[model samples]
Target: MTRFDIPAPDAAAHAAALERLDALVKPVGALGRLEELAAWLCAASGQVPPPPIERPRVVVFAGDHGVSRLSAYPREVTAAMVRVFLAGKSGVNVLAREVGAGVRVLDIAVDDDLSDVPAEVRAWKVRRGSGSIEAEDALEPGEAARAFEAGRRVADAEVDDGADLLIPGDMGIGNTAVAAALVAAALGVPAEEVVGTGTGVDEAGRARKVAVVRAAVERAGERVSDPFELLTALGSACAAATAGFLVQGAVRGVPVVLDGVFSAAAAVVAAEIAPEAVRWWLAGHRSTEPSQAVALKALGLTPIVDLGLRLGEGSGAVQAIPTLRAARAIIADMGLLADLG
Candidate 1:
């Protein structure tokens, strides 16, 4: 896929962090949220230092994969579940509202068409869905490029809508292979290191997923070291776009909370593109596999939540946003004992 350039955050987020530190009521490292927000804000704005986020935005990127069509789960389940989320019945809806974080769901690619999409949903449908990976490259180079543009467009909208933090969730079936491939490509690790039991894959199914991924890599016909090329060879539309968005968000001085394997893999790709991109990213949680540990270790990120939750769909990341908000509040609002004087 052709890569587009989304420059890093232009605001002085680092300087903002320094200024916030100077303004903090207590001694250094005394305020938590204030510190996080200050640093986040400064980095996002591309300031020599990053600054604090005034408003956070969460976007769910949904698609369908060719590999999972053969899995135990039916493809239709993806569309049905996405509808549930749009109706505000899902878990992230609840968590996002708690933090006053505006949430938007985008249909990036689905196996089935959602022509009658509700006014509330955003559709950047690349196609009905990706092709059968077993038979083809899964996504054409052009299609992958489109997905990246779609993600960047959404990020632009979120910025216009006054969201300082960008959180991404994926809703595609058979996405684990895409993530594992991307991670493997970024880290030079085998696909097995990145494959995890996503959406209830049994032991047998997990084995099959791994084999399919290994085959996908063999078919790619390129070295795994060049993350972008490997991405074009192994990445899904959602992953490609999300990678671009991550890069764009960092360049725009926006702080991103990466959800799970899919989101984290994209972060790995983002790091490959711009090593500094990972600095603006915060890992949300540990995912369903040990490979996630490998991926996070490669990124040098620590998850805030450690519950053995691997139910993708960005649920884990949304759940943790509240903790981050609390962290920010503790530093921003809590009174120091010295203030009592």
Candidate 2:
């Protein structure tokens, strides 16, 4: 049971940012969502006309689920994708490059040895793979706490090293199922409503995923009221880690851009752990997954964009970085109407 001392965003700064946006040369309310983004930035950073997003960082938590048979892809794909991310060849890499954000991949619970890979990548691993949620707890007795601490350490390190904005990504086969189950348990929703065609699962695959989510949710039962207990019962090491990363990011007063359903599900758990942390997060995009919208609604967050993005590896959030930069620039560089007079 980790306690997070997350401070609420600066209300005065938010008001000052809105005043500045209204005083801009453009007509009032002309910038639409951009104005909202600028104000959020001000509140998150606790500064009027917040500093530039110079060093955005993406942390991809890679793992494997014992219930990955429900996924369209094999569990080995998680490790393979981690390698691709490390090689700077994934979709997130391309998008992160476009936004000048550095990417780091951690093997939180990959089933593979990854012996040849860099040691730093596997430094935070909790286990080979999480247990199958439908039949067993996702983590052992204390593994969930360890994984959560690993995520918090990662966020603290990134923020200490000058990461201005954080994007927590996911890389795990069958993680969508894990995410859906977690969200269903958190929101008391039916599995059918939370389940989606993750990784292009066929109709049969989706049905199987829904069944697995239902079973996991049922198994979780009363644990849904306790964030850590819910994560241990239904979430992978990656999910728990992501939840911790998000919470620590807000605790450190760093703004985060959440990715798809995977991140969104973790966010629901994070919000449960620290309700004030929601103010430091921005929904980067609306994922095609229905569970994402449900989780976002629970958090009272509106997505900045809706490009139908379902890719999970922080691709959607990375793509939205430019828009965040534009928002910051509008506040920092735009001429004020009062200046003209």
Which candidate tops TM-score? 2
Off by over 4 Å in 1: 1-54, 119-123, 223-228, 335-341
Candidate 2 per-residue lDDT over residues 237-335, each given as its tens digit: 999899989999999999999999999999999898888889899999999999999999999999888899888899999888889989999999999
How close to the true structure is residue 162 of candidate 2, measured as C-alpha lDDT? 97
Per candidate, the number of residue pairs that clash is 36, 0
Model 2 steric clash pairs: none
Candidates' C-alpha lDDT: 0.71, 0.92
Positional deviation of 210 in candidate 2, in angstroms?
Answer: 1.0
Model 1, 77-135: lDDT tens per residue?
Answer: 78887787878876777777776776677777776667667744644777666765545
Query: Cα RMSD for candidate 2?
Result: 1.1
- Model 2 residue runs over 4 Å out of place are none
Show the lowest summed lDDT stretch of 10 residues, model 1.
1-10
